[model samples]
Target: MDNNSCGCNVCSTREDLPWEGRGTDLPIAGCRFTLYPMTDRYVDIILGSLEKTDTSYVWSETDALSTVYRGKLPYVADAVKALFVNAYRSGVHMALEGQFSKGCPGDIAGDSLLEKDGEAPNAKSAEGIHFPVKCKLALYPMGVGNYIDDIAKVWYMAQDRGLEPTTIHYATRISGDVHDVFDYLRDVCALMDESAVSHYILHFTVNCNSPTKE
Candidate 1:
């Protein structure tokens, strides 16, 4: 692939091969945000908790649910929310929390590659919106060098079709609307080949809201 730059799904310069309509703009998910803490406390804690769980739990734990919950230690439903509160106070956005769940070694929840449906006209009739999207993201786990680069490629593709970048999180603060929240799950799943993950959870701090919120 050539290093072609893209802005809002279209090549600001010109539509080169693989550049025209290359990115699909999907609607953003509702009511979600990222956490960015300056000192990395939130991310450290979350990843630390996750690390506690053996990456190879499939060989040890028989119960799939238990294995996943173990990583989300102190396993509270508001695991991410709790982190967000702390991070928000301390000025952080380290977790990079997603809608679906952490793509830990064995997460299988929402494992299927889904497609995104644009914002509906009367989407406000319910508390949660399920985006039936057909999307695929390839992850080179150990290939750390260009993971960021590759993700950018996919990101642009999404943005082109109308899937906008909801916000950028850093030091615990966020800058996006509800749509971004909805897409968070898809973005996370796309970033990691989450199909292999056994079990997972996504925290919707704002209940009256999602599978997590409720």
Candidate 2:
């Protein structure tokens, strides 16, 4: 069993029980100490913010983020816009991608074209895009593929969320807006209902440019 599910008091209690867990004065590699009252304060601070909003709020330009979805997403629609403009005093064509990146197995996360002349990637290619605005989607799976077509009124389950995406990406753009990503998923799941596939995962984030496929 992985360390997280371990029921030992060390795993269940104080996480600060030192990364080097001890019992009878012997250190264990995966053992941990109980969470002392001091560390609980930090956990409270972090979780307290999560309970505040399901989405990012307008952050002042100077605030920092070591985590995403918990802290505010940098707002481009407000005074925060100035931060991005001022950051690019060097006259860049576009914001150079940052190192903060992750992806599913074999998923592409950046630009497909080489030097502005390379051929565009193919369908089923994993691609990414970034949106200047934030939009949320409440997606409900419609069975799997065409079998879902047999089920009436699946879209209505999602229609109530009031999200209309200006840019609809097939499977390429995995960033920017979760709404667009889910829209594509809503379409795909309705198509895959009869295929060999049983389930799929959709991942979305801020601006990532990699192609999802090789």
Candidate 3:
């Protein structure tokens, strides 16, 4: 195989491709996120965070909208957490909007990433960094017949964890330490089963140091 070749469902030259033999059961994950820093120094904050965070385990790209990370789930999650924490500035309201996806039928470009493995390198260093955050998230478990029931179960799960989420239009709001929010999200993502969902996406926004008077 050439270094540039992609052995995915759409490009594989092999007769017995995995997807054809069984199915497209890759564990590839991705995250696209944009950070909004509430200050004139926003550019510095965004760039600085990118510099400090370690994204070596993942394939990453940045454009006008947001930074996209594609790789194993742990690397994708840890990269997001480390970047957000690195960008934290006290008294400056910062917002990060992100979309995390797994098992998407169209996501074949990063299939090679599955061969790469190990713990997220930056996760250890970013541990124990605490900050308050308010977040809103919408979870979609695709192709499930009773999606509302699954969604409701997540709501109840959050309540059980003592992270009572407030119902808002199009999303649910949860307030807590940054670590807790991320942990909750990890669990939420884990709730999806391969046999049930064709694809799953979690759209969320985390805000810290907001100046909102409410």
Best by TM-score: 3
Evaluate model 2: give its TM-score: 0.20
Per-residue lDDT of 103-140 in model 2, one digit per residue for the tens?
11122222121121122111112123223323222222
After superposing candidate 3, which stretches have Cα over 4 Å from the reference?
Answer: 1-24
Q: Which of the predicted structures, 1 or 2, would earn the higher lDDT when compared with the native? A: 1
Q: After superposition, how far is residue 5 of candidate 3 from its true place, in Å?
A: 25
lDDT of 3 by residue, 170-189 (tens): 99999898888887887777
The best candidate in terms of lDDT: 3
After TM-score superposition, the amount by which residue 155's alpha carbon in candidate 1 deviates from its true location, in angstroms, is: 2.6
Rank by lDDT, descending? 3, 1, 2
CA shift of 131, model 2, Å: 16
Error of 1 at 22 (Å): 39
Candidate 2 wrongly placed segments (more than 4 Å): 1-158, 171-198, 206-214
Root-mean-square deviation per candidate: 16.2, 19.7, 6.6
Worst 10 residues of 1 by lDDT: 23-32
> How much is 129 displaced in model 1, in angstroms?
8.0
lDDT of each: 0.31, 0.26, 0.80
- Per model, how many backbone clashes are there? 41, 20, 0
